[model samples]
Target: MPKNALGAAGPAVLALVLGLWGITREDSMWRDEAATWMAAGRSPAGLRHLLDHADVVHGCYYLLMHGLFEVFGPGLVTLRLPSVLATACAAAATAATGRRLAGPWAGLLAGTAFVLMPSTQRYAQEGRSYALVVAAVAVATWLLVTLAQDRPAARAATWRWVGYAGAMLVAALLNWFSLLALLAHAVTVLRAGRLGAGRLPRHWATAAAVVVTGALPLVLVSRAQARQVAWIPPLTWATAPAPLCLLGTGLLCGLLLRRRPGAPARTAAPAVSVVWAGLPLLAVPVLALLAASLIKPLYIDRYVLYANVGLGLLLGAALAVVVRSWRPFTALFLAASAALLPLHLGLRTPQSRVDDVLAPADAVARVSRAGDGVLFIPSLRRDTAEVSPQLFAGLDDVALVRSPADSGTLRGVEAAPARIREAMLAERRILVVGDPEDHPGGPGDATKRRVLAAFFVRCADAETRGRRVQVYERGTSCSSTPARRL
Candidate 1:
């Protein structure tokens, strides 16, 4: 392959190999990914109904995955394959963007940096939309670079601008937060003096307008469903470090590139263009979210995952400069590989997630007898059972009013507090799955725990990664006190 072709292909190959390494591990799905399975595994009409109730932001992605599930089945590999492929696309697009702005050396380094990013690898092996959004952002950035370097009178330029618009539309649809990239693009346009002076700016603006217009319906519906992210805490000084660190890292790398031998003579991209392509895309979103967070907390690192592409581009350029000699470059590559060894091993373990619901699920399967009852404290922990249905197959969810499929909901509907209490009384043995000793005070959960405490005695308890599994026997209570009714 030509050097440029090799540069573009290398990152993609690396991402695929790394992504597949742990794609089908025994690790249990986390709550969010379980939600993906639940949403995507549903019928189209059911998924639509579920979205209308909650998770509207993920509607498009769920629909896309629903089709994939139909063709491929919902095994772990199938669930995560879309993300893996998307990340591979992102790797290639990052390389192409770097090649356009700088040179093949910069492209090769940038693409490699993207593949090696911890966050990139993390999401690439999980079943989620972040990788897809990252891919869209990267392709959009590449298209923007192409458009910027093209003459307005050229027919190819118009087509490239249209492609940019379509990429933006896909990005916005995948995750509404991705539309934030447009603000970065706006800054680039202004910096380049393309606004109002050229056909490119007008076309860019028109494309942006179309994206916004197309996304309006989803934006309105998803905003009304904003309670989905209600768990995000208000921003503070503590929250400032992550974005600052990212921005600082990119800028520091850019500065280091200046120390290269005859740095100005070997330049692949102009300093101004690099700043235009990189700084705004990386900074504007973080700053915008920081500003928005003053009113309501919306800042989360994964929301701006695409910004990592800018950081990778900047870092690649610096690395290219610093390791100008082949011997030093080889040494650096070997050192990075060694450093990543432990991380790669860690990613394959079940304990890598917030909670290895798999361990708890396995424990429940072992202890619970046929016809035993199951309860998920805080309700959402039902995802544990949902993800490993076969392991929990024989046990009945005593508190479940409707199955996830029947209810068209992510976690399924719980019975009324009184009904749940009644159901718990009838079971001889019950399995409880939840966070360890951190019960959220809710009426249904309180009623279930109260009934268990009053009527049953704990038989066994096992702790998993971030959850607990407990078995209780109805007649084992030492207390003679009567169980209270709700």
Candidate 2:
């Protein structure tokens, strides 16, 4: 195969193989993915209602997966396959971008770097829109590069402009934060002197305007649902360094590549352009989010995950420059593979997740009998049950008034305080799933703990990763039931 084809094909194959290696591990789904599964499981109308009330930004992705589920049926492999495929496309597109800007060697290196990055491997095997966003941004960037190189007098420039517009539109729809990529593209155009009185600027402006117009409604709706990001804490100086280091490393690598021995003298300019093409994409989104976070906490690293594509390209170019001969390049690749062996193995284990819902689910399944009652302290621990509904299928949720699917919400609705107390008093053997620290807090949580203390005996308490399971038996041995409030 030609070097050009190898540049694209090699990275794609690596990404696919890496993505599928542990695609169906026994690890339980985290809350965000559980939310994806929950949203995708809903009927079209129910999902639409869910978007109107919450998580409007993810509406497009959920709808896409909903259609996929209709054919494949819901499972971990099916849930994550789209992300894996999208990551492969992103790897191919990254290679093409590097090939366009520099040479086939740079393309191959950049594509390999993309597949090797820990973040790339992490999200590629998980069900989410970030991988798709990365792919769309990469393809759009490649098209923009093509537009920049085209002769102004050529008739083909118009079609290229239309394609760029469509790609940008798809990217923005996937994740609203992807719109930040336009700022990066704008920097590239300005640096290339394409923003003046020329066809390039005119076409570029028209495409950007259309994308913003089309995305306006989603922006408005998602803003109304801003509570969805309330978990994001205010930014501090600590949050600034990691992204700065990443962007700085990419720029530094590009500089090193530009000055490398045996590199073509004429290639200096393209190396600079590679840095310009990538730096803004890596920096602008992070800076914008940091600024916004001063007002309301909106910054999170994964929100701008596509910026890593630029880092991968710059790193690839640097690698190509340092290892000018194929022998050293091969050695470097082999060394990286050996070093990543441990991380690769760890990714397949349940310990990799924020919380392993499976361990707690399995614990509950082992002890609980038919007709046993289940309760979630602080209510949100219900996410465990959502992840493995089959394990929880036999236990009745004593406090749940509406199922997540029925309520069209991420966490199901809870019954009123009176109904919860009544239900708790009636159960003979109740199993409570919660974090240990979530005890005896808030109106509902306090009420549930108080009722359990007053009317039950602690039979067993088991601690799993990030969760606690306690079994309570009906008895007076714990504490006397307090007088009921009318």
Candidate 3:
């Protein structure tokens, strides 16, 4: 392999190894991954119907996973392997970008840093579009660097621009938030010295326009489904800390990348360019999203995961300058690894995520009896049953008017409040599955709570991390009921 290829390959291999270390998480799947599975498992017509109503933002990723599942069959490996491969691709692209702006050592270190970051590692193991978006952005950024640095023939430059545009379009299709990466690239161009002089600005603008044009339809369609993100909490002071910490780290890394007094002009130019590119790529998109969130609350850290590439570039370059030798670098790497060992280990556990969909399924299976009715307090907890349908097969979902696949919605449309009440009252015993706190504020959930409180009594219950399963008997007394653990 060529020297550049070797630099890229090392980090890519490292990412793959880390990503696949405990890829299955002991056969556990969380709500998000379950959502992916449910969507990907749907028939083509069903998936298309789903996109027409909701989750159009994830439509491209769902389609891709659907194709993969059709070929490989659905399992933990099939669900998560794409993310692992995408992370490897992202690491390689990060390394290539670093190599273009700094030295080969800088590229290698940057890729390693990217692969190890907690957020990167978390998303790398997840079955989602974020990893793929990161890969696309990294490759686009590298292409941007190549375009700026090399004054290739017009035809060659146009092809590179086409590739950049295509990469950006892919990122946008995966998740529109990734379009923010272009803003970072624009900042890099505006900061360029010799690189930004001449036709570069015009070419960059043209390619960017192409990207926007290609992604315009998704942009518009997903905008109509904006309510899908209504659950994201508004920006607050607590959310300020993570972005502040990242800014502080980026600032420190930027200071380290500053030129020394005797540094050669050729080297100084590249260092300046790297900082110009890296800082904006690291900070602009996140800060922009946060600023936007002040008005409408769309900020989510995972949205701009591509920024990690910029982080990798700066940190790797800083390490290359400060460590000076492989021995010290290796020692530092080992020390950092030792510090993060517990976190790395914990990330592979079933309890790592917010909630395990299977946990609730297990709870339901233990507490439910044949012909018993099941109710999801907010209706969304139906996802637990969706994930492990076999476990719930014996119970009747009394509140559900239609299945998720049949309704062309995620949780499926629930019956009216009165109908749900009538249905629950008819059941001899009912199972309620939801979060521990019973505040589903929706009308259907409110009605279920009221009816259960007035008519039925809690007979047996099982509580797991982030979920609760309760059996409510028709009568007021539960004297003969036994406590259960799930």
Candidate 4:
């Protein structure tokens, strides 16, 4: 291939990436993302306060983004650029891996497949580390495969291993659970018997040493923070682990896993195949079981995004091996995946839908005219990312009740009855949510039921994909007089 041709692949694909990124830019932040922004925005001292009192599972990611916001500033675009850049680089990396192991066709298909997976595109569009983690995972895995396959070790292989180790370390720093992917990679390498037995032990010892040395402090800190954390429930076939994993994996890697190679590497077909099919399948269950024992039961699909690229490349590899003459069918498959890109962006990319966890604006629209006075029930704030901003920061009138946050329309309420009454009286209409009744006082689920029904008139009732948000109007009192004007 001409050097110019190789160079063309990058910018050619980058154009598509730049365009696709624009389409997913306005996606509303889900609960975790919103909280991430809020937490990272706090001053260094305030962040320390948050770590001691709030979720510390990803304090490093928070700190990194804090630095990022210093350079790029905040809001949806500034926040999500990392994921977008990570995914775009992953696409380029996928192409390079393919071109290295197979050929130009393989590289193109692999990159295309990467951008098409609903999950890949979805995470790429979010303001979190999942996309970056997955990209690092792919780049690292490719380097590891390059290392293992070297009959006569080249500088490339050493650089690849060095890169792989560094990538794994960065991923661990961003989100520790990503260690599961690296662990699975190690296991797959072990199971394949590729690294001579003695070499294998040495290789693993280094990996273990790195993971323990790097991740140990974060793990210890997380233990202390767990006391204040809520219990994450177990996974089911449906939603425990993200449902996207099953569907995306099936669409992307299922065929490649079971298929036998009919053709040779277009560029190392055999070993790369092992990394593709095995790591993700092993990583998911391994993490689930391990987490069940030590941490609160939990599974989030985005955590394993590195596996998605492996699947995409394998999918590319399978096509390369099997579809020797079926050019038209290959075109069709690629086109269909590309065509679905908009749908994924529209609904899944930002994790959006009619029934998304309440939009921050919904909380804003309610309190916009209340002289910017926003009062949010802290209990409800815990429910989703929109909790703090949408509920209170919709405008300048934001206040926190049942919360330690000082800058708000109301304060020191402690979910107290007198306080709820006071914020309601001071603001136009207090938009209480989640367990509305339980905060101030209640016998059970019905605790705040009567009060909400009695005073707050139902303005809107709606549900989508199971997330439900109801708007209520408090009957006109002197407190609500200004709201009527709104």
Best by TM-score: 3
Please list the residue runs of candidate 2 whose C-alpha ends up more than 4 Å from where it truly belongs after superposition: 152-155, 194-198, 258-272, 325-330, 439-441, 476-486
* Residue-level lDDT for 150 in candidate 4: 55
lDDT string for model 4 (3-100, tens) is: 42552266236624653555434445565566667766777766666676656766777788888887878767767777777887777777666555
Which pairs of residues have clashing backbones in candidate 1? none
Question: 238 in model 4: Cα distance from truth in Å?
Answer: 3.6
Model 4 misplacement above 4 A: 1-20, 23-27, 151-160, 195-201, 227-231, 237-263, 266-296, 348-374, 377-413, 417-486
Model 2 residue 217 lDDT score: 88
Candidate 3 residue spans exceeding 4 A from truth: 1-3, 193-197, 261-272, 325-330
Q: lDDT tens digits, residues 1-486, model 2?
A: 127689888999999999999887575666577788888988999998788778889999999999998999988888899989989998998887777666777788889898888888888988888899888888888787766654435568777777888888888898889899998888877776643324555667889999999888889878888888887888778877887788788779867765762333123333226666777777778778778889999888888889888888788777777666555766867798789979987886666767666678889998788999999987878888887889997788999999877777777889888889999989998999988576555677788988998888887787786678988889854233332211
Q: For candidate 3, write residues 313-411 as lDDT tens digits.
A: 888777777666345776877699679878989999888888778877887877678999999977878888987899998888998889999999889
How do all models score by TM-score? 0.92, 0.91, 0.94, 0.75
- Tell me how far the alpha carbon of residue 85 in candidate 3 is from the true structure, in angstroms, after superposition: 0.6
Task: Estimate, for each residue in 1-486, the C-alpha lDDT of model 1 and write its tens digit.
Answer: 128688889999999998898786575677678889888878899998898788888889999999999998877888898999999999999887776666677778889898898888888988889999999999999888766654446778878877888888898998989999999988877765543335556777888999999988889989888888999999878878878888898778766654552123123323235556777788888778888888998998888899988887777667666666554775877698679878877876667778765678888877777898999997888888777889998888999989877786767899899999999999988888989786566899899889988898877776777788877778766233333211
TM-score pick, better of 1 and 4: 1
The residue pairs found clashing in candidate 2 are none
Off by over 4 Å in 1: 194-197, 256-272, 325-330, 477-486
- Each model's Cα RMSD: 4.0, 4.4, 2.4, 5.5
lDDT of 3 at 167: 94
